[model samples]
Target: MAGVGSEKVFENDKVIVWNFVLEPGEETPVHTHEHSYMWYAIEGAPLHIYDKDGADLGIFEVPTGAVYSLKCQDGYLEVLSEIGKGARVPATHKARNDGDRPYREVLVEYKDAMPAGGSV
Candidate 1:
């Protein structure tokens, strides 16, 4: 299966770190997030989203230096903080850079925080 990010930068028993980068007009492969994860944006951009079936979701703004934590189960994701509390979306999806500059982020997935019976 494809990873959730562009590249696997590091991994240990507790977590995996990824360096995700998207050039202008580039898109990632449809991927799944099975464990809880967090990401820090290095560069900001508007990202167009598509579900696993290639259905368009919408454009999401990613602000530089922003961070987000999410929990996943059965291909659905829930925001872990109060800022976007009660919101959930499909976890199996792809992101396309819809801006002129490259978008970059550092993502970390918590292996220990996986839902019961979950595996990467």
Candidate 2:
């Protein structure tokens, strides 16, 4: 288990920036997103996701230059399911690079935006 990203590149009172890179066939350790965050993809690839118990979730396509913002909230999965538009990044899960090319993204987590008790 680790933090939200592969490496913590920068951090201050307001936010934490992370560099997330996954080579082909590489998988990240189980991690949790407890704060509101956003990510900008540097490279596009298919990412396979699994729950903490190793249950398959699905393969998600990361579009090049795509950016996503997520809020930390209780019952986020339910909320996202109702919305039915954005990809749902689980509160606790692991991700594997399923494509031949590497998957890269820069993630910015808002420390101040962390929900009380880190629900997400």
Candidate 3:
């Protein structure tokens, strides 16, 4: 939950936070998000794909320190659920769905935040 509630702290056109690193030879399998994403590749090279229902959508390469935002409108990524709500992804630094795909990222979703004039 990140200790956040369903309330407005402020308003914005959009917001997201994340960090990622990849060792040589890695990729993140096709996945979906409910909010949206601006994937900023911090370190290492990564190959990203937008997929829906086990089908191919599009392929993207995110190099170190790059950013990309993905949404259902962009393509069909069979969204299973929303982020920061109830859907929980398996904590990384642990499992592997399929070998050869090792995309990693630190994610933060839009939610209630510090009020105005609040120090972060």
Candidate 4:
């Protein structure tokens, strides 16, 4: 796998923050996310998503300062169950900058939490 061009700026019990940057024509290597996350685009541009096999998924128009959130495919119960059973799985994907300018964003990742009622 290649490397992701991002740095961990902060982390705490509740969340982890990352400072992501990518120059024009640059790309992020295949990466996985174990927790839910949202991103605020500092300098957005067109981007292309690709699979692990290098197949193009699609292109997206990212607007400057736009914010977006994504939930892990595994639900809360699934995550806990996987942990309990000693299984680790993460959502994987790769991204490429297709625009002329650099792309930057602040990514905030949420920590795992139990249900409010203490049950699934």
RMSD of each: 4.2, 4.7, 11.5, 8.2
The candidate, 2 or 3, that scores higher on TM-score is: 2
Clashing pairs in 1: none
Cα lDDT of candidate 2 equals 0.74
List per-prediction Cα lDDT, in the order shown: 0.80, 0.74, 0.35, 0.67
- Model 2: per-residue lDDT, tens digit, 49-71? 89989999998777888776676
TM-score of each: 0.85, 0.80, 0.38, 0.76
Model 3 per-residue lDDT tens digits across residues 1-120: 222112323345455454443444543443344453333444423343323333433333444444443332233322222221222232211212122444454444433432243211
When summed lDDT is taken over every stretch of 10 residues in candidate 3, the lowest stretch is 90-99
Better of 2 and 4 by lDDT: 2
Count clashing residue pairs per candidate: 0, 0, 3, 0
Off by over 4 Å in 3: 1-31, 48-50, 70-104, 112-120
The deviation in Å at residue 88 for candidate 3 is 24
Clashing pairs in 4: none
Q: How much is the lDDT of residue 67 in candidate 2?
A: 70
Number of clashing pairs, model 1?
Answer: 0
